[model samples]
Target: MVRTMNKCDETTVLNAIATCRFASASDAELLDAWTRDQLAEAFATLVNRYSVMVLSVCRRKCRCVSDAEDAYQTTFLLLAKNSAKIRHADRLAGWLHRVAQRSAVATLNRTAHMSEPDESLGEMVVIDNPLDEIAARHEAIILDEELAAMPERYRAVLVMQVYQGDPIETMAERFQTTVGTIRGRLQRGKKMLADRLRRRGVVPLIAISASMTTQVSSVEAASAASQLLGMLESSSIPPSPPLSESLLNPLLVNGRNLMSPWNLGCGAAIAGAIGVLLMGPAEGLVGASGGDTVDVVMAQKADADSEAAAVQFPAVKPADLSSVKTKQGSVAKVEKVDDPEVSELAIRLKGELDRVSDVSIDGTVESLADELQQQLGLPVLLDKRALAFAKLSPEQMLNFDSSQEPLRTSLRKLLDPLGMKATIENEGIVITANPSQLVHLGIGTDRWLSVDDETMRLFTEKLSESLKLQFIESPLRQVVSQLHESLGVNLMIDHRALDDIGVDDDFPVNYSLGGEVAAYDAIQMTLRSYDLELTVRNNVLLVTTMEGAEESLLSRIYWLEGLALDGNFDSLTQLIQTTIKPDQWEALGGRGTIGIGPGERPSIIVNQTYDIHRQIESLIDTLRSNSFHPQSKDTGAHKSTPARFGNPASGFGGGFGGGFGGAGGFMN
Candidate 1:
């Protein structure tokens, strides 16, 4: 069979997958355009959205280029014809993926006799014949289907994190679980998936899953072009194929499946050549289905910026927590706040601290810490970082005779000289640098190298890479274009936001770097001159005017349920407002806002910048950790705790204290 049509440059497809913004149009938006059939670029935009994924599958399933091309076209054609019939827009990837799988299968069955087996080509590994290829493809498809059929919480977490590239933390919030739980579920879920694969006489294709996920996850949501024109083009497309098979899910995966039957016999040939891909190389080993012993093998560095062998994100073991923790601190928005409110628990804790105890610090501060923890009946943990900042150490002498003084007063006298303050978190009393002092720790120090936008993992990867950039007083457009080209990332500027800063395309940007610096810092440095901040909205990064990211606000509720059990939330709100970014508060003539959440247990709600928000979370958590609590192991759950929180925020309750809407936002 003679190959027809052009093969989309595999490199372009890969690059597009990594940094291409599906024209910043939602699948629904893109489909709407494709259905309208007005603009000449509609088909192009729609094709670009899933082209990488479709072609990836086609490349594996088809024996020859011509067959793969036909199959790829047929897959999109089905989407084009049935664009209007798609009900679940969010799962468009999943739906299209399944469709592509089937289309490839169907296309192969139709042309099985046309081509005489296959040889080596493209990025795929060599296969001796089509039969072996079929078996491997069979495993991958079965794996996909079985994975789809598993419990959603597990399946969702796996796919979103591993497959689609959503961060585990994002998945936690989406699934409303803890970070630990998300990781735990991934292990359990992977085990279950592996078991099913093994039961089917196939070794788990987890390595393949990981590799694929890593690749797709690297794709950033922010895309290329004029914001309006890009949107318009994405929504407009060429005529679609006749609406035949829309979303055909025989096993029913992802959102209200519309079942459709196929007339052709199930193809005997699977993409057997993909056995190399499915089985991987002779040397690579991802962790077992169990969680532990996950290895962090550095991937072979890409030969160039465009090398396919370059796995920027390889399947690292969960044991490689340093990177994950780094991301948690930088890549992900770290809400360091766990509000320790003033309530019955707080009062009890205060009482404990305030109790006059026969205690004396005659030895090292470590001895005093031990006595305090035992005497106050609260866990004593030291914040080493805070201790360092305060210029104190556990070995240092904190000599004091508090035989008649309250623990609170005694502890205060010892720490005051060191610029240390004690706060009660749910866990125990924590000795750390005073909050007033720590605020200075984060002030004017936000690099934002990794925080926000999971879809931008690849973009974030680019942002973190060191580059020697030089631009001599270039126009903003020129600056944006050059950076986009260098970083290979789509840079979308919010013109309206620029207008807020009285800046425009012609705004002169002077950025010069003689040495290699992270692109993230570089971009921030470039935009900082014009008071611009980056934000992700509608799955696209927006170069907003210096309102934060200033204007971008993420709201989180601090559940001080245990501490707030019997106290007014007002004071807690005040503590947060006064301590963290005081000037940023709306009450203090800043854009930030904080308030009491009206719930059975008092909850504090605040809207702030990712930076300040992180501070607030830290502040709350610190307070809760040091705060004292009265507890009984046999005590039943508290009725005061709201049901949604499910677990107690502290010692007193089972769920939420309460929550409110209209959270605060940030201004850069």
Candidate 2:
């Protein structure tokens, strides 16, 4: 067989495959074997023969040479894999071309990190009205030059689609991605091609026919230009064959029946062994799937996927396409706000944080707060609403920057009606409130935010990290001081105290918040006691001494669900004492509201899971107790608790509780 052959159109190649008689009866079978075995060499041949065409397509798809190269390599890889199944020699080129085209498109999809394949590539192309008479040959040359000028990635996609002839769906599946992703890529590729053409003087205007293409000068046209044009006319170049058949596997694998009897036997044996192992006594040692672990892992994976799957949107609206050529770039937009108060608050609050950008924090916080209210089944408090005290007003600002005594006095006056108290400290603040206060405020920590030894460890670590980012290593103290003045509070660190804790005040802290080792140690000392162990590394504290720690941690997280649901405080306090063994808590649950009681309202703790039935039961018990009952409720005089727990607006029973939704002072 000849190693090199004359250049021919894809159609001519297909005809040769259909007509030529091979010398051996097993030529088809041998070719099929060669498809997988010598795919590299076979692919190299295809590339050598069609490199120019491929380059042209890629040029049209990308904005630069590097991008085109990526697309080209990707397309060739696809061809190498798919070439084995092609049965007929005549149809191979056509098939291969199509696959190559799709591969280019897939490359764009992957690079752009899209979720869907674009279907708009076959749409009409528009050009300016004036360039029609430049001569067909000249137009082809111009188009070629323009395509080559584009980035490599763009050029590759164009080559794959327009020149290689691959379909959209094939490209999507080959890339192991979604159709939306492919479509997004194709859309980007088209816009780049259009832009390149325009820059090269081929303006794509409304007047130009979308179907315009390069044409060879006709004999009659040649004659018109020069009275002897007929003598100078030449035959037009024939169109190449379609690239579709040249690259498909002749033996298509049926997806539905992927496993043959032999494969099924192997799979069944493997499954059985896995099942047996899972059923063994060692299964108990395998442990329960930690819910918190799963949740955190899932959350992390979701974030990564979101980042990687961002698609570059086309300028064309999802609803309309004719107005713009393409999207310039992908970016977030800021919201328009007309209210001065809300705008001022947003600006002030956003400036006081880190890690999050200024433009986003304001929008996100308000949005999240609104969502939280809805999730908790409560109406949000607003300045214009009846819950005036809940809103931040002039009276609410009572010397927030002053010493603890004045601050505490002002907070007491503000929260007295709600039965709450505030404990002010230089470095910490704790809020104490009754169960009724929690019910009214619809805000409190629960299982999710519960202060377990581990949680305290995590929180302290996070705080330490935050402090480090803001103070220890940061030169932003001056800026921080200014912010404290604006917010009316002092945020300072004692260099000596930090040194005593084994952390250098000179350590630079990142602006992002997350407690460090010292923070965790402080937390252990101040909140969790010695129930948990803490170690610091790279400025991060790892607290991991609790026995059955994973299970305990999960429970703690589940308990937070109660907090998110707006559960009461004392009941939660009781639940913790009952659920966690004394040995586990280091005797922390023995005093005050720290222990559980049937009549108390639930405390919000992190990592606790309770069903609706338990939640209702808990609420009922609290309403029957004096903790949430109004002072007028004279036990026996109250007659009896209501059959069903009613809304806060309606009292639980005669004179038990008349109103709902009260303020809860901030936890120090």
Candidate 3:
């Protein structure tokens, strides 16, 4: 979340919030939370800004008052639920109008499931005028529906003239068009709306069919919501949120000194809003309990769920995970049992691994493995992949002893004799027998990386930065530099690799992607045709060929233990190995190897290029998030699933174009 409140204070939010200080505070702008207080404040401003328009929309479509309240709450609560996905701040009205109407419909649908409906919630007016047989609220709903779909260029003019009460001449100045153009657009937009309403079999009301000759004021007597529809600053309103803040509140006046209790009450409301909206892993944890701390906890949980919903992973079958290798260096075996004893075995294993005590060892690799499992009570085994590389067998003798240290440290010492290390994978201990002969394994160095590295820490942040550009046949260097500028990363071209691959720095490129794309994926997408990939060295991003990346392999271990409990661990590793960079894994004639860890929660030891490692990290992080919040069937069409790159292919369907895409330029 952003922190726009940092620039201004409560005094500004309560008093002179009308000046240029907040002139550009769009709905998207106020959705950030650099600090917890900013999230509270920005959300408060958004609620106060849009409550009227949203309420009016809700009141129009929902027949029951309770349904209206539910719709209203859902509209705002969903806004807070998917705050990060609000890419179009200027069209906040359009977004709200659509969502508010959809929410009203959803609430009505939900009410249909009730044993009995409340008939007294709202009563429809029976007007006397023949031309106005339907209530004005009904008419507004029909017109608003048509207006929402119209191009902003045309519908915006109509809204300015009708809703905000801007004159034709004034609108021309704001739109940078002539008075005649404004009037023509206004008349044409109205006629189109009238035609649409007619096609829907909605009988004409003078308020809808009349041309520019009729003013919105003429229908004031017919509409119950007429005052709110037209240009009228509310004398007073409760501080709340919905849609159409700036669109309806053109003057932006009457900034109130929100009472101290307002924050407390709003905090409760905001907390309840999220609690009612989010599901999945956060199913029963959300609460409306009073406290700033609860707000932070609930909001953070919601944000994580939101991110989980944002990333999409392909479906994999459970059987696909069956028949893989079981705990350490055991031969490939089919795992076929529920094993009611799993919890007990897991506790025993944890106790063995966590024990900090003296230990001694002297035996063959087979004997060492046996000691780890049968004696120490750890579910230990060896990985054949690592052993195959090291050309070592379980019969090989090994020796080591330890004093008052973790069992894990002693296990490493035992494996250290040969170039292998131990990891917990596949619900047991996996002794990964990697080549210890090489001083550099593309790990924990400028050539390789660990999670502790600053660059590694910034991996998620840098990849999440959006990149959009439109250039026809631009030089490769120019495109690379442009991406560097957009992503704010230390991106550089690998000239040697480019030359070795017989590609030129000025290779003419004709590509256009006008939609949501993270910079990491964007780099891969633009360079895919040349067989290029990204790698890191000295904490700097390097663009190199897939061949260059393979020359110097790095090894990193991923603990997928708790992350993939919802699905098969082996299938997850297979998904990563096969799809992330299909050609690079050892199975595909490349240097990379993904060895399954043993335990209930699975893990994987990967030896690949750094860039590929980063991609794996993104995938696991996304999957972990989405596991908490499986997508909902109720709001399928309107669910906020913004494009966030996890798998390398997240950008596949996003390559749409009419103009330069903007994140910095819109498929989404």
- lDDT per residue (tens digit) for residues 273-295 in model 1: 11211222222111113222211
- Per-residue accuracy of model 2 over 1-668 as CA lDDT, tens digit each: 75764333333343234323321222233334436465222323344444545444443444444454445554444444444444443233333334434434445554443334222221112335535433332444445544433333334445445544557665444433334434544554565556555655665331122213421123212212221111112213211212232332221332011122223344545444333322222110111321211000000012211211101112222343212111222222222224322232222211111111111111231242243234222222222222232322323322112122322233334444543433211112222333334334443323333334444344433444422223333532343343334333323433332332233323332233355344323333421221223322222223322221222232322112112212223333434333333112322211112322121122222332111212333443443332322211211111122322222212211111111111111211
Q: Any runs in candidate 1 off by more than 4 Å, and if so which?
A: 1-46, 111-113, 120-123, 126-166, 169-192, 205-255, 258-668
Stronger candidate by lDDT (2 vs 3):
3
In model 3, the Cα lDDT at residue 3 comes to 62
In candidate 2, what residue range of length 10 has the lowest lDDT sum? Answer: 292-301
Report the Cα RMSD per candidate: 25.0, 30.8, 21.2
lDDT of each: 0.47, 0.31, 0.47
Model 2 spans with C-alpha error above 4 angstroms: 1-36, 39-139, 164-166, 174-176, 205-212, 215-668
Candidate 3 Cα outliers beyond 4 Å, as residue runs: 1-60, 64-89, 95-384, 388-399, 402-559, 562-668
Error of 1 at 516 (Å): 64
Clashes of each: 46, 110, 27
